[model samples]
Target: MATDPIHQFQISRIVPIEVGSLDVSFTNSSLFMVATVAAVTLFLVLATRGRGLVPTRLQSMAEISYEFVANMLRDAAGTEGMRFFPLVFSLFMFVLFANLFGMFPYFFTVMSHLIVTFALAMLVIGTVVIYGFMRHGLKFLGLFVPHGVPGYLIPLVTVIEIISFLSRPISLSIRLFANMLAGHITLKVFAGFVVSLSALGAVGIGGAILPLAMTIALTALEFLVAFLQAYVFAVLTCMYLNDAIHPGH
Candidate 1:
């Protein structure tokens, strides 16, 4: 079980709770999710609490994260999008912290679950839809109609647009889930190879060097991926929110 690559993704119940027919059990996944949120909250609070004229390392990191998301949102959705800064910032931080937490040994990756990522994607799309209609009324449907399509092609274009819009959540969710799942599984397999090889003999120990190096390299790459996935998710979210703000485009 220790060498099983798939074993690492298992979600064992930490505190089983049954509410009638529903199982509201708190599992390792739930614990890690709570940890992720708490970590992000605590980091932000502690990092900015001092707010010194000369910023500390934590303060600088916090400030840089703020500005990075701010700039990305602004560029994608313009100044009006700043109103959604809280949402965008929260999503970015939550995802980033969650991904980073998964890099630790024995940690359960919440984002590795399709359901979790799908739920988050739905939240973004749901916000865009609800806000779009509430803010623009029926005009929100204009998002599916292009600005300069010929009359005969409008129907075809509209249909395509609608399909594309509906697929957003699926694509968004799968992208994050698949990347994290695949990366971790690959890493686990390579590391398992190293362990199994080392156990064989003196000859086997030398044979383990390649897999060990690969394990180290993959570890570094996964860290990079953890950050990039969060960034991509945030950027795409900003683009989607832009449709809500300006449906004509």
Candidate 2:
């Protein structure tokens, strides 16, 4: 299985646990998730521990990330959305670190899983719905009714809007999950090609060079994609939160 492109995505139980009929066994995916959280926590703690006037490299990074998300939220939802900063920031950092960690050999990419991404997308949508209703009550339904629409078209437009809103979570989750899954699989396939080709005689070694180079290029591209996906997720989240704050239009 060393050269199997799909083998890397396999989920294996690291610590199998059986609680009656329920299999809540801790798997490689679980381990990586915990690792991602721990890494983010450690980085933030260390980054802000000193609070120096002349910021350290870690502190600079932390500050930049903070400002980046802060500006994103502020611009999208205005100052009111800053209330959800912790949630947005946490999601961004978690996804980013998880994606970065997966770049390492043998690390499980939790973000590549549909269930995981769906859960996160649902969390954002849930927050929007819960907070929207809590703050605006029945009027929050105004989100489905566009302004200045003719009375006859209102019903049809409302139905369309409702459908579009409902699709948000599915699209959000699939976008992240699909991108990571496809990128990793492609990377693995190219890497596997390098290995399989190199295993042959001298001519095989020479031919392996192309795939090896491609693997390296794909590796760098994947890193860029990791950050972009996280950013897109966060930006979309801010826009959704804006809907909660201002449900009209």
Model 2, residue 126: what's the lDDT?
100
Query: For residues 1-249, what per-residue lDDT tens digits would candidate 2 score against the true structure?
Result: 987877888889989999999999999999999999999999999999999999999999999999999999999999999999999999999999999998988887889999999999999999999999999999999999998999999999999999999999999999999999999999999999988898898999999999999999999999999999999999999999999999983
Off by over 4 Å in 2: none
lDDT of each: 0.96, 0.95
| Model 1, span 27-91: residue lDDT tens | 99999999999999999999999999999999999999999999999999999999999999999
The regions of model 1 sitting more than 4 angstroms off are none
